[model samples]
Target: MLMETPRLVGAFACLEYSFPFVTMARRWFVTATGIQVRRFVPNDEQGVSALILPIQREEFGIPITAEDQPDLKAIPTFYQIGTGDFWVAVQGDHVVGSIALKDIGSGQAALRKMFVAAPFRGKEFSIAARLLDRLIEESTRKGVTEVFLGTTDKFLAAHRFYEKHGFQEIAKEDLPASFPLIAVDSKFYVLGLNPE
Candidate 1:
């Protein structure tokens, strides 16, 4: 079903514990259509993993060292356990990508860990732009006045994506220490969803 608040559009279905079944339905829709999109759910565990792992390896190029694999494992778990607002894209039963928005503070949030799998790369920008449009609108409804993100240097594509969607680089000196993982070789950007 679809629900709308002034800030965002939300869609959901209760699949009665049939994740694989729902995945199949999503894939079929993708194969038949040119693109597929949906809100992210905690139940999309496997699809979430599929969407994330390749991005982690490719963007960070962290070798399978003693600490790497477990770190990679920790990410999706963090996403599942930490936040409730996520979005997913699917094509013909395969999950192609995902993005997450997490509340950071009063009237603020963070966009985190966005990725698009190889097969869905070309449409990444448009898909993400549309999703963010919805998410930002929804955030306004939920009382978020701004949203921020920390993105790695390697994600040149993502940096461009953020710019096109109206995010601006935040001066490093002005950033708060409380921004999670913000100091870790990533640039920060902010979008004023409710500009004064």
Candidate 2:
């Protein structure tokens, strides 16, 4: 008989991963949440964008002019070339979160724009951790040596999350005018994906 437990303190939406090939998908199955890690696809654009946009607005206090176009461009630049890629966290029919590995050469990739929806933010769901795990696996598959990411000073929660995932703070720098926000405060993180 299945037991119904009390509401988990921070239970977020459930993530289920399905891959076309059983073998490839099995290799990256995370037992903790049973989220099977897989490669991102073109159809994930809208779901992934929805998961990330509000966080961007909150962090930078700016708006995305055209959501579909920006995400659409990334399909060819990041996912298609095989140099970099991303993975999405899906539960039922809805996408809860996503993380991308941006190849920056020298066997290095950057973990960019990870976000879980407001309704599903916390440790119990393990969204961030699981996504990073999948990203590291993808980097290893693509022969990437290391990954780096940049965050703003305003995102203390994100900084903490990165730290928990073994990302170390290396530097802080100015934000280019091209970025949506006019703020100059930004922080950088470096993480070695290879296990010791």
Candidate 3:
């Protein structure tokens, strides 16, 4: 004998006990949601641009365009070379977020291009955290001892997130000589990987 139990079907709390086996069985059925974080490929240029440009320009009111950011136009050559790497978060066929690490040498790298689509943010989705985790794992594997980042004061949420993830705020002048300080970046941070 199988017992029937209510199943949740969305916004409305409707009790559905149509399938008794589905309620009685201890087996779990996992479905693919098509969300993934992966390395950047040449084919992702358009999707990456589509995902990042609006956030930087329209949302934040940054004057820069996608064309002005050469890195977005040449991810493979600019980010995939040496110890540098770039990753994107995708749902189905749409790119939702992106993060990149730039090898500045001296056991250090610069974190850049951290962006998440408006619809895919927050702890429930964890898209930003996944992107950052991927970058940090890759950095450690590549022997990067420190990871530095630069951002504008406008990104208050980003500041809190970075701080929560162990990135200590640092003075701009303290950045590595090789760290590329963009014009819009007024705040800086560094995360030391190696035990010091």
Computed on alpha carbons, the lDDT of every model, listed in order, comes to 0.58, 0.59, 0.79
TM-score, candidate 2, is 0.68
What's each prediction's TM-score? 0.68, 0.68, 0.82
Candidate 1 at residue 48, lDDT?
A: 64
- Over 53-167, each residue of candidate 3 has an lDDT whose tens digit, in order, gives 7677767888877658998888888888788999998876556789999888888899999998665678867889999999988888888899999999989999999999999
Give the per-residue lDDT digits (tens) of candidate 2, residues 1-196: 1111111223332222223433111112222354434556778776566456555664456554333336444754655455578777775545667777766666766676677664455766677788888887778877876677776777789899889878888744432222232233378777776632
Give the candidate number with the greatest lDDT. 3
- Which lDDT tens digits does candidate 1 get at residues 68-131? 3342234444433333266677654555667777766666777775776543456533666666
Candidate 3: minimum summed lDDT over ten consecutive residues — where? 23-32
Model 3 CA deviation exceeding 4 Å by range: 1-32
RMSD of 1: 10.1
Which structure is stronger by lDDT: 2 or 3? 3
Worst 10 residues of 1 by lDDT: 1-10
